[model samples]
Target: MADSSPSLDPVELGAYFDLIEVTSLLRHAVEQQLREAGELSYVQFQLLARLGDAPSGSHRMTDLADGVVYSRSGLTYQAGLLEKAGLVIRTPSPDDERSTTVTITEAGRERLAAVLPGHIEVVKGLLFEPLSRDDVTALAGLLAPVREHMRATPPRSAAPRRRGKVS
Candidate 1:
């Protein structure tokens, strides 16, 4: 192995490790709860939640991909699955013929309704139980800047896709 100096200080390393472990554990539990309650994947639930929250009850496929921070191809595939299940409908966007719009159906809303209680419970039990209100406020305050900094770099989904064949 090539030798390299350790860059992170012990405090930084501990914080990073703690963040990773907590997110991993939280995601695992959330995924299980989503599957058991609504038969949805974490990504699918995110998509539905976004659609449900949209004023128009719909969003462009590209926007959804960006909003969810998912790959374009993966978002397309997940949308297809949701379409097959009759939980969402994908239509050619009225604003842009080349783009698709995904809208949650009534069934999708119902599925979310079924899942939310369990989802909230899981989040509360695993992520919030140990934290006091002040702790949570401090955590959010501490993490917001980090999240913003990471987001300063454009997400892959924000880039223009090459259409057809590249010369």
Candidate 2:
């Protein structure tokens, strides 16, 4: 009988696992920091941060969905939560009758300000503290292609959320 199990090269598997482990740790730390700083979930923080950085203090909900790589319905839920918090406003997109735009409110900006320092410190401590400057640069270069490759396919989250579970 022929052995038919698929095998990845050990070095490739190690690299893949290392990336996953590091990002998992980083994500949990940042999520906790964001929750503590502003009572924001990670997705809410991402949405607010994106809105805060827009040149005109607003962005299309579609664009925000893409920026955060989150499902449109999920982003909508986050937006609603933020709006209820007085942290953001959602209005019809003036440029598109069918689209919505989200703008950061004063409270949103305040929340972002509250979140930034801790976010920066947490990221720096977790992601950069162990790396040399050259390692940082090299890591960015290595990840760029992988990110672009994944982005080319625009994952399912790029679309609206499914209404029901599959049978």
Clashes of each: 0, 0
Lowest lDDT 10-mer window, candidate 1? Answer: 153-162
1-167 in candidate 1: lDDT tens per residue?
A: 88697699899999999999999999999999999988999999999999999988899998998889999999999999999999999999998998999999999999988999999999999988999999999999999999899889887776878899978
Most accurate candidate by TM-score? 1
Model 2: per-residue Cα lDDT over 37-98, one tens digit each = 88999999988888888888899898888888887778999999999999999999998988
**What are the models' TM-scores?**
0.92, 0.89
In the order shown, the candidates' Cα RMSDs to the true structure are 2.8, 2.6
Q: Model 1: residues >4 Å from true position, as ranges?
A: 1-6, 160-167
